[model samples]
Target: MTKEQLCEYRELQKEIKRLQARIEKLKDKNEGYVADVVKGSSIEFPYTQHPILIEGFDAEKKQASISRFKELLSKRVEKSMNRSIEIAEFICNIESVKIRTIFEYRYYDLMTWQQIAYKIGVTDESYPRRIHDKFFEDSPN
Candidate 1:
């Protein structure tokens, strides 16, 4: 696997988290609509029509909007999750132990170079980076 493809895992994870947050926000807004309906806050008169009927109309529109947005966010989350799984599998399949460790620590786990060095029993943080660069340099593109 190329360095660029492996490096994309961190950003995909971030996007998944962001999309999940948006889904949660949509859920919260839907709940607020329910609460507002329960509290009769949206009640208004067409004089000839029941307040309940009017409220239902407004609530349905808001509910549809929120549902559509939540559905879109959910799809985005699924796509990111699938890409993350592919990257993780690629990282796991690398034959070199140290190189795999560097990829996992740097990309999958999102660890700093210093932390990776410590984990791999090296004194210098740059050690991991050097190994990574050298591996890619020697690898066939």
Candidate 2:
């Protein structure tokens, strides 16, 4: 991958991490609803807890918001993965399959360039780095 593409990949990776944390928070918030702990007297309202919402807790509205947040999380994850795959595919589009493998290992699998070189059958770890550099230099505008 080009240096610009690599930067984009890392940015997307960070965004995914941030979004996953949000998803986790939403999941935790949704899971906090337990019928046993709810405050309700039988003589007042006995069906579903609606009028007597817990302070700062609107069960139905909060659940809907959580569900929407989950949907957003799914889309963001898919978008990041898809874009990364597209970049990887572009990196692989050269005549050599090894470049594609190297890019995938580096970006997708989070492997060191040296590890990629080793996996790609290069005796010298720096050889793959040089080849990728040449590839970047030779790329068209």
Candidate 2: regions farther than 4 A off = 10-14, 17-21, 30-57
Model 1 / residue 112 / CA error / Å: 1.5
| Candidate 1 lDDT over residue span 14-133, tens digit each | 999999988877755634233222223334554353233223235677778888888888898999899999988987888999899899889978899999999999899999999989
Best by TM-score: 1
Residue pairs whose backbone atoms clash in candidate 2: none
Clashing pairs in 1: none
Residue 29 lDDT, candidate 1, scale 0-100: 69
The digit string of per-residue lDDT tens for model 2 on 89-108 reads 67666677776667667767
**lDDT of residue 1 for candidate 2:** 45
Instruction: State candidate 1's TM-score.
Output: 0.75
Against the unseen true structure, what C-alpha lDDT does each candidate score? 0.81, 0.74
